[model samples]
Target chain A: MKLTDAKAQFISSWGAFGTHWGINRTMAQIHALLLISPDPITQDDIMEQLSISRGNVNMNTRDLIDWGLVERVLIPGERKEFFTAEKDIWKVATQIIKERKKRELDPMLKLLSQLEQIEGDKKDKDVKQFVDTIAGIRKFGGQADKVLDVMIKADENWFLGSLLKFFK
Target chain B: MKLTDAKAQFISSWGAFGTHWGINRTMAQIHALLLISPDPITQDDIMEQLSISRGNVNMNTRDLIDWGLVERVLIPGERKEFFTAEKDIWKVATQIIKERKKRELDPMLKLLSQLEQIEGDKKDKDVKQFVDTIAGIRKFGGQADKVLDVMIKADENWFLGSLLKFFK
Candidate 1:
């Protein structure tokens, strides 16, 4: 495929994939564009390239920055702000993992723990099932929490190599 | 909290959580309801409990079955179909991982590989960055695919035990 066509395909696909994972299409497309760009780009550039509005470019870029996947940079001689994505995919993955664990997993685990303490007799089958399911999820989430913690802290090469070797 | 209230809270929260991960709210709510129920429930029961329409329950239940998280069971002499969720949290996690990898990750990795072959000079910065980004994502997705395969086929106790130990 032609370079421009290939680029558009990648951006569109990435946006769709992102929506499946609960990220908005525009934000993901912006991220994809930044990922493949060789240099930082301005909001106007992003809006023009993606055919999105200025307000859209402004908001999604802020969200991306909050997610630690993108950053704002000052141009050497220009007054406009430029944005760039972290090009290292490993860092990108780990950063997302860290943020999600903080946002979702930690709170869910805490709630599960509280729910397990619901007043009930062990002999009641309904109570037993509820407790058992909640406990099982809590345990599994705890294990995942620990695993993700290690992964976030470990170097990508070391972690990936070890995991691949272990699985093989 | 009262048992019924607590159950309601759990179901509501789980549905909200599912939305963040791209699962629909109703589907997640139904799954959560099934997860905690001691007995298999029928379509009418789900509708009454969730305050949803029959059509909504029917569609979401079908999707839940499709995802392998819920199953239809025949009661000893009952005329209606009953549904139950796989309450073993490990099984639930593995099943989801298996299905998502098949649906999303596999296709994405395949596309990335094809994108890597875009005609371009390796020395061009944009070309180099695009190729590198695609390669990195493909490699990561491939590793995840392998790891998920191992997890899916593994016995729950053995897999979690090994992973916890490895992380420790």
Candidate 2:
């Protein structure tokens, strides 16, 4: 395939993949575009390339920045703002894992902890089942939380290399 | 908290969490209901408890079954079929990982492979960047694929035990 067609395919596929994982389509496409670009791009350039409105480019870029996956860039004499994504895929993956652990897993684990304290007789089947399920999920989530913490803190080489070997 | 209230909270929380991770609300709610129920429940019971339509219950339950997280159970003397979720949290997590690996990750890696072969001069910055991005992603995806494969094939005790120890 030609470079242009290949780039389009990657952007579209990444957008679809992002939607499946709860991120917006346009946002992922923009990220995809930035990931492969050799230089930082302007919002106007993003609008023209992705066929999105200025408002959309503004909103999703802001979100991407908040997620720590993208950044604003200042050109020496340019007026329009430019943006760029973190080109290192390993850092990008770790950043996502860190944010999601904070945003989703931590809070869910908190809720599970609270649910585990529900007042009920342990002998009751309903109570037993509820407690057991909550405890099980809490244990699993705790394990995952620890694992992710290590991943977020460890260097890419040490973590992935150790993990791949351990799995093998 | 009262048992009923606690149950309600758990169902709502689980449904919300599921939506964040790409599962539909109703389906996750139904799965949550089954996970905590000591006995298998019928479609009508799910509808009444979750306040959803029969069609919604039927569709989501079928999907849950397909994902290997829930199963149909035939009672000795009942005309209506019953359903129960795989209550082991580890098993449930592994099943989901397996299904998503098959459905999403596998296809994405395949696309990345084709994109890696895009026709371009290596010296061109755009071409170089694009190829590098695809190659980086492919390598990461390959690692994840292998890790998930190990997790899927592993017994709950052995895998989590080994993983937790390895991480520590």
Candidate 3:
């Protein structure tokens, strides 16, 4: 495939994949575009290339920045702001894992812990099942939390080399 | 909190959480209901409890079963087919991970590998960047695939005890 066609295909596929993982299509497309770009690009460039509305570019760009996956760049002697994605996929994954752990996992684990304390007789099958389920989830989430912490702190070599080896 | 009220809260929250993870709310809600129920229930029971259409319940339950998180239970002398969720949270999570890895991650890595072979001038910065990005993602996906394979094969005790200890 030609480079341009390949890039377009990659961007669209990445966007579709992102949708299944809770990220919106446009956001992932924008990230894909920025990743393959040799230089930081202006919002107008993104709008023109992706054929998206200005509002969409602005909103998703801000969301990406908030997620720490993208950054705003100011060119010397240039007025319009530009954006760039974190090009290192490993760091990008780590950042996403960190943010999602904070946003989704931590809060869900907290709720599960509270639910486990629901006042009930242990002898009641319903109560016992509910408590057991909650406790199980909390324990699993806690282990995941620890593992992710280690990954976020470690470099890609350590994770891909040491960790993967150990897991294997 | 009262048992009924607590169960309602758990169901709603689980459904909401499921949305963020690409699972539909109704499917997650059905799973939650089955998880908390001490006995297997019929489609009519699910419809009544969730106040959803019979068709909706039918569809999501089938999906849950397909994901291997829910199963059909036959009660002797009972004409109706009852359903129950895998109450062990560890099993439920492993099943989900296994399914999603097949559905999303595996295909994604395959695409990235194909994209990596795009005909291009290696010296061109854009070509280099595109190839590098695809390679990085493929590597990460490969590592995740390996980790998930181990998790799928592991029993709950081995995963929670030995794996957690090794990672820690």
For lDDT, the strongest prediction is 2
lDDT tens digits, residue span A1-168, model 2: 999899999999999999879899999999999999999999999999999999999999999999999999999999989999898888899899999999999999999999999998999999999999999999999999998887777665676667654422
TM-score of chain B of 2: 0.93
The CAPRI class of candidate 2 is medium
Pick the winner on TM-score between candidates 1 and 3: 1
Supply the global lDDT for candidate 2: 0.91
Model 2 C-alpha lDDT per residue in residues B34-57, reported as the tens digit of each score: 999999999999999999999999
Give the Cα-based TM-score of candidate 3 against the true structure.
0.93
Candidate structures ordered by DockQ, highest first: 2, 3, 1
User: What is the clash count of model 3?
Assistant: 0
Give each candidate's interface RMSD in Å.
Answer: 3.0, 2.9, 2.9
TM-score of 2: 0.94
Model 3 whole-model lDDT (C-alpha atoms) = 0.88
Please state the error at residue B23 of candidate 3 in Å.
0.5
Point out where model 3 deviates above 4 Å: A156-168, B156-168
Candidate 1 lDDT by residue in tens digits, B3-67: 78779989999999999888999999999999999999999999999999999999999999999
Q: What tens-digit string does per-residue lDDT give for candidate 3 at A45-137?
A: 999999999999999999999999999999999999999998877778889999999999999988888888888898999998888777777
